[model samples]
Target: MSDTIAFPYPDYLLGEHQFRGDDVRAFFAPGGLFAEGPIPAKEIYDELNASFNGRGGSRIELIREAYDSVTFAAAYGAYISASTKPDDVVILVGHSIGGEKALLASKATLSAEIDLLATIDPVSRITTGFRKPLQDVSVPESVGYFFNRWQQNYPWPVDYGSDGRIAVQDTASTFDDQLKQNDIRNAAGGTKKRGCTAPDYLKGFCKAFSGTTTTTRTDHGKLSHDDWIEQQLRNIIGEKLEARPTIETNYGRSVTEDDAADQVFRWDVRNHVFSWGEQDTPSSVELQVYREGERIPELSGEVSPSGSVDFNQYGLGEYVFSITAHAFNSVTIKQKVIVQDDDSSGPTITLTGPASRRIADSAPLTFRWDATDESSVREVSITATGRHGERLSPGTWASGGAPVSGSFSFDAQPPGNYVLSRSAVDDDRDWDGSGSIDDSSVTSSRSTSFTIYDDDTAKPTIAFFTSDGSPLLDDSHTESHGIANSVSWSVTDDSGIASVDATIYQDDVVIRSVQVGANDRISLDEFGPGDFRVELRAVDADSDGWVGDASERISSVRLTVTNAAPDVFAGGMYLIDEGDLLNLKAVGDDVDPGDADSLRFDWDLGGDGRFDDAQGARPVITWNDLVAHEIDDNGDFVIRVRATDRLGASSTSQATLTVLNSAPALVSIDATPVADENDTVTATGIYEDESPADTHVVTVFWGDGQKSA
Candidate 1:
């Protein structure tokens, strides 16, 4: 047992205990909405203190949620900063919603180096109002290991009444049934209900758990105190303590080496062995090497006393060597070594090409060169200087092997006198032999010159027109009046026309294209009624290497083939008596602004998929006019209306009209003024009916219980 100590604002001290040897610290937090109380946290803290008594000296802190003054995240951060040391073995455990808080705290205090993090039946419902619901929980890189325990069958209740009391019990079926009932209630009242269940937390936990998770059938409220969970915690803590590293102190003399200390070797040297003196013999020796500023151990192992270490595989660089000697006490020695390249011989190159001469601008020119080096040729670079002294880089190429030889070709350079210079470099100056060859005093150079003449630099011009010889403006709209429209274009270039490409696109997608001469015409018969774009590109006969040469041009025009089907806004279920007049208005409009008033409407009151019953925007229909065979089994008739545009594109809408049967009406009944017992009586009834074609029968009843028809 340990004494209870009070902490600052966010951290409330539940209990503290000190073990014997290892420096370890554990942090625990309880679970609840906002984590305002600390009953379960205190229980787990006592168990941990008792379990860690014989293993090592540890400090345990129970962190309570202090959401009043600060958030749970900030409170955990402050507690970590105030209570933890950099070298202590840290363990963190949280239950329920506190598990989420623990994960956040792990990220906040990454420098504390948490060894383990365990969460029990973790839930993240508090932040659901503003943030997205937790889908998966990711383990922070700062934690060495992670453990998660959860229950699946039974979930804790989350929905509360107006008085802030949970509405349902924590049973599996009870919770589910209550949620279903609440959904029905909410649907009837037109309100939304919020709930968090065990499956919600399990789904996220399963996605995040890299290793096997502990799934229990126990309820969420008792999961933290379950026997299996307690045993798992004990086993993990014991293993962590056993694997903890022991503290070591340096108190012996430094080990001395006999090789040239901190020696620098050229890249040409392959092998180097470092040996220690035999006079101060040590029982055992260990070696570790690392690059500067890097903590990764490049090479590490144990060697015999007075033994030599061979570093033949290491490349040219500066490295630190650490050697440890174990005898009466342990001692470590550090030294540095540098490896570099010192070659100074330059490469030799020779250029061969035609002498300075004039050639057509469309002709291609080629130059060849060969370079040789003592060690190895690394790279070759070339540059061209135009007549105006402007420079153009031909890019550098790596040799890939020893001797370098290649050819450079130029295609239709701008009409000018150009000097092409070439350079080559060997691997001599590449210190460390990393292929870092550059232009220096050891680089070889050569040059050649030529002149290009008569280059055309004028783009082509384009113009468009309609079939009527009227200029067709860009981004223009036109109607498809049941006939194809024709468009013409003219293109001219000074160099000469190579080819013209004309393409028609509907809704940004190409529907038709053709290769035509400089002057050509196209028809819009194949295209449908929609917005379209026309693109025309002209290419000149200038043989330049680059695409879209100086004398190439592209033009585009937007064409809207303005004709669309009318949108019909009609369809409903109606009830009416037989022979009753049903007035149905054709409600619709054309999408095209110019075609709205030109729409025509027709009706199909018989449901025969024909629009012959009537014609107009609004039509009065009658049951007697409907075809008897067209009526469905339910005594209902479907009245359809079609709205068509001037171009014949149309849409149809329908409605269901149920014709109900009408009963006969009675006007009055006539009888004798007085009737004697068992005497004959006569009655007459007058009735009116909407269905005048039906025959009627009348029945007369006397008080003596005898009826005649």
Candidate 2:
């Protein structure tokens, strides 16, 4: 007898379907396929169990109905109790849902030695609502040899059968994509419908047909007893399994076999270069140089028996040197390198500004220059001298590299001659073949001279107006009701105005200033509600405002900005009778709290959209007069209130007032006397009302007892 035993478990509901029919006669009958002749799977298990006198030492256990609770629990408990031994092969063969139970069984019996675990198209427990589908469970780690074969060609719509696929994923196991035995090739030769062919009734019943049905009855039920599955079982029993191989990254070595980091540089003052690859290896090495983190390498080359790569002719920056050494396998190593500057010439500085020997005394002295170096310049400085040829106390300075340019300014210089000078210094570094000058620390300077003169120029005259062609009647002050305002101006200067500028002021504080002319206009878009002033300054060739003497003028009008409208809030509605003195309040408030009282309230009693009744600036109003025309069908009317601020800015609010109908009146009431305790007593009354009500309830009470309504 074979030392190993196969504990076969059939899938869910199909276990009996696959094992109990003539279709599987070849699977049990001896000499047909197994050579041992007819023997049921359970018979094999029972014989093995009885050999040990039912003491529970069985070579095989056939677990059927694995999807059923009772059968599965009993089988699982039995498998767990069977103590497993080393060198003993416990082979498990499960199909469909039975496959799920096999995995569960293995997991439950942690100590059981599973030499081989094979599965057919394992499906989930159909009766258990598919809570844990057989397709989702993975093989337990305790199993040694795992084999999974499934189909993937189930017919459309009726995809209940295997599609030639299984969810069991064991990367180290024997996985085969086997062709399902349900094919027409495996079916008995016949003209009648069989195998992949569907019955005429089935074909006609379906709306559309795509060839023969893949789920032929012969295919689904005959899989477990098929010739191919039997051969797999035989193969497992014969111990014909292939070994799985693994790949390695670093050849499983604790230390590298190459020297890379210590090989690359040759630094020099004027020029430098990096070289590597002196040692020879079994295989050629590949070198790549990058600036680190960057995918694209700046330089790349291969290392042969006698090859060295140069790493110069580049800008000054940090770079990464990477070596990919190849031998029986490959390995990577990285190193960092920094390239320093190498230029030795002093940067040249040039100055340019007012070329005239004399400039307006009121105008500022503006000087500009450019500095450059072959490699890099560190700093630049500027100096000045007075008319008497005395050097100025200090100078202006800037710092940067080649191709740098900037400017410096001096407020209106006193009427005198002055000289402005500038110089640039290169970075301190010595270079080979740079004459006697280290170039680093070398400096270069330049200077220019000019004089300031006083001039006489009068302030410019200005005027203001609205974009709508309305002149400020006061000429110096006006008020606006909206944020959008237009201001137009014109200026005149005796010395010929070079340009005109306007400055806006909020009360006494300056807000913004802009250059303005006859063709230009100003919009106070950002100006909130407030009082402001606009001042104009015109500069001529003498640089009046550009210097100390500013020719300026102010608007003749004070602009009172009341752009925000007052928010109106009418009080709650009320129901009142005619001739009643009703008090109502329609309050108004401007954005600026102080302007709240400066609002006029207007009332539209009938909500006719017209404010015919005006209440000056009073927010509270008393209404005693109501005309019949103001009442609608429901005895209701809307009262709208509009509030207009002193600047004419306005907003509106409204409320509805509903009138009530006359109350109901009782005409008379009568009561009937009761003769016995069980006798009924009645109370009745007559009433009238101008309004309509849903229902009327009446109640009668016994003087010494209860009442009903």
Candidate 3:
């Protein structure tokens, strides 16, 4: 007999069934202080029980807390020592705070051994300052295999603070010392622990034993139910169960090697026959076949003891066949037969396309392919990838008719290096002959590379128009100064218009370049009076590196800008006493050379927009000459200046002049001879002021202390 058993069941059933009366005792412990409904620990326990004890023959327990874990582990150990065989498997899994308790239970197993010990994100309240130390947080030597998973950044709720709110603490690293000592070998034959030391807050446990430390990003709360952790547990348990022995039993009797010797069966692949020896002819025989994961009823049935089942109607690929035979002494024998396809030939394809061509001159590029296969063709797909490895949408084609050849075409594409790929599939893997191909069908792919070059040779055309959309001829345009004179233009090209730049030039010298849009006005107010020219250069949006014709790339209009109004600088405010002479000066300049030397100036002293008070660049006048209507209450007069170019274009400016009033002076006093003190005396004084707008009051004094006016 073989020392170890190899069951032909699926992976999920590895540890679920009992073989040779072996027992799998599994213990699970959850975190948190309360045993709530549907906790992670209970869920994990249910799943593991379903996997390990699906036949209701194994022992599994869910411990709610650390105290209960210790009590249950001791009790279960006693039970194991009394009833379990030497080959039974013991598994212990714990999460969060319960992980520490599980380690303590490992040590409490005494003479019993734990086949597998798994801890996920363990936390210690004593090390985190929540309580006093109670037990050793280390892996026991009694553990045959250890798997540890941990995180050091997720927070856990602790006691409430003084503010009446629950506080959280990062206790993920509370068991670092225990983890460092429990490091084991990884799948690569290297140590799970890193060589360098990390800080306490950043330290974590390594998830080794089964493989290298997992790098999956997980938190403390989610580590208990993490998919990686659950898968690791299932894998370790499955491995342990598969390494044990298998004992064949009949109705209440054990089957000896001799009793099962003649029940052996052999599958004949070439003949599609499943036949067994003739030793079990005293009872019944059963046969079943499964394709993919489901059974095929037409291909499975009961047969005679020495009979052979035929599978010639089935198609290619893998199929699982199960056979059972019962002997006259109630000895039952079961076996599995796997039939796989031996055909190796796949679909053949030959793809063809152009090597290189210009997108502008080349017609629609045609792609053709011929596919041939021994089986019916299922589908054919095509894809195109550009220069930057970006995929262009060409759409996929699928057909059930299984065509052997096909052709397609692509319109003119952008200039770039492209790769065209075609793939064909054949329906050769229909294991049950259902006319539908399985995912394991034969597929063949072929790729061909091509390049599309840009060959745009058309230059952009520029057309100038006035504001009213009328065509404006080149060199026949005249624009007035001091007014907004604008022109519009349109640029177009066969490829596309990239940019249209407008530049202004004065006397063959470059001024400034401006941006222009279609039908948008280009203002000429910024240009001074001169022989100016406006040029527009249009560039096509061709992506090729070739520079096409440049002779007709630019269009220009040479026109004469007429006279510009002279700029006037009127002298600033002036202050003079009444009867003092005031001199005023003004300066003028014209941008047009023809009008520069002939610029004229005029002034308006009254500030009424009429420059008739004075003429010439400089004028002089006395303060007293200013009319009363011209000088304001503050004795201020505003003077204006107007500058005119030779073409009669004029601009005006102004300044203020302040005049001070002069005091009246006494000229002469005339008095009649006053012989007596009571007689009336007459006195008069004459005053002359430079300001004619001022009126004066007079007073006279007599010799006897009485005053008369």
Best by lDDT: 1
Q: Mark the 10 consecutive residues where model 1 has the least summed lDDT.
A: 178-187
lDDT of 3: 0.55
**Model 2 off-target regions past 4 Å?**
1-283, 291-299, 341-363, 368-542, 545-709
Model 3: CA > 4 A from native: 1-271, 276-286, 291-308, 325-344, 354-366, 372-403, 410-432, 437-443, 447-591, 597-600, 605-610, 614-641, 645-709
Candidate 1 local lDDT, residue 157: 32
Which model, 1 or 3, shows the larger TM-score?
3
Question: Can you rank all candidates by lDDT, best first?
Answer: 1, 3, 2
For candidate 2, the per-residue lDDT at 113 reads: 58
Clashing pairs in 3: none
Per residue, candidate 1 scores C-alpha lDDT tens digits across 194-274 of 233455466442222335343323344555555434444544565566531111212123333323164444453545455
Question: Against the true structure, what is every candidate's RMSD?
Answer: 31.2, 33.7, 18.2
Rank ordering of all candidates by TM-score, starting from the highest = 3, 1, 2
> Which residues of candidate 1, in runs, are more than 4 Å off?
1-271, 277-283, 290-299, 312-315, 327-329, 344-403, 408-459, 463-490, 500-539, 546-709
Candidates 2 and 3 compared: the better one by lDDT is 3
